[model samples]
Target: MTATIEQPTKVRRPRATLQLLRITLVLHALLIVAQPIAAGYFLAGNVDAMTDIHATIGGSVWIVAFLQTIVAACYTIAGHGRLWPTITSAALVIAEFVQLTFGYAQNFAVHVPLGTAIVTAVVWMTVWSFRSTARLSRREAKR
Candidate 1:
């Protein structure tokens, strides 16, 4: 005769705070993606109207950055996200401010590469947030 034992399984519940964070991350990624497209249209002379659209998109990035910071705070306070995401989000806000400054000053040397880096970073974070179950579990464990 053999005795078999089954271990208890841990069930994870989806939290609204995490859901909000995920939504914000997705929006941030979209905003980051749009900025370059708008700039490209303006630079290519495809449309003179694209200049205003580009500036509008650039300004909107600041609003998204602010939203990201708030959502990061909510996630941290709720113990649903790790410290790194919040830290990176905060850093990105600062970087965006600098990027805006350089852009307004027409300093393409810093503005172009910085914009590229921002887009890459935001996209990476958005993908990671969507795919990292381990991170989600670890963060929930801290609660």
Candidate 2:
């Protein structure tokens, strides 16, 4: 008997919904990172405009977080993917809203810590989205 070697299967590209999820994840992460930078500029008195820019970035973060939730839902249902992304995205939306409220209220005690949490969550999701575990097929998800 002769032994035969098997070739590994080629990796396939992610479906459209997953691609959208990844894109939104990256975009959301980028926007989240910009928040602290803008705030730092304002705090350092580098420019008066930094305050408005920081506020604008916060609003943008909320919008993108909302959009990410929608995309994650589509990815989960339409693409037959894991549910965690959807849940995480939704939580981010709620957190972002609270962050904005506290910021406007000048509640730095809450706003500052919440901002740190938001950044950590966004970074975690962004990193996970690109990992091999995240790209596993629906079969693995069911298992």
**Per-candidate local distance difference test:** 0.78, 0.87
Per-residue lDDT tens digits of candidate 1, residues 25-44? Answer: 89989888988888888777
Candidate 1's C-alpha runs over 4 A off are 1-14, 47-50, 134-143
Model 2 off-target regions past 4 Å? 1-14, 47-49
The C-alpha TM-scores of every prediction are: 0.80, 0.85
* Model 1 poorest ten-residue lDDT run: 132-141
Q: Which ten residues in a row have the lowest lDDT in candidate 2?
A: 8-17
| Candidate number with greatest lDDT | 2
Per-residue lDDT of candidate 2, residues 50-124 (tens digit)? 567878888778889999999999878777778889999999999999999999898999999999999999999
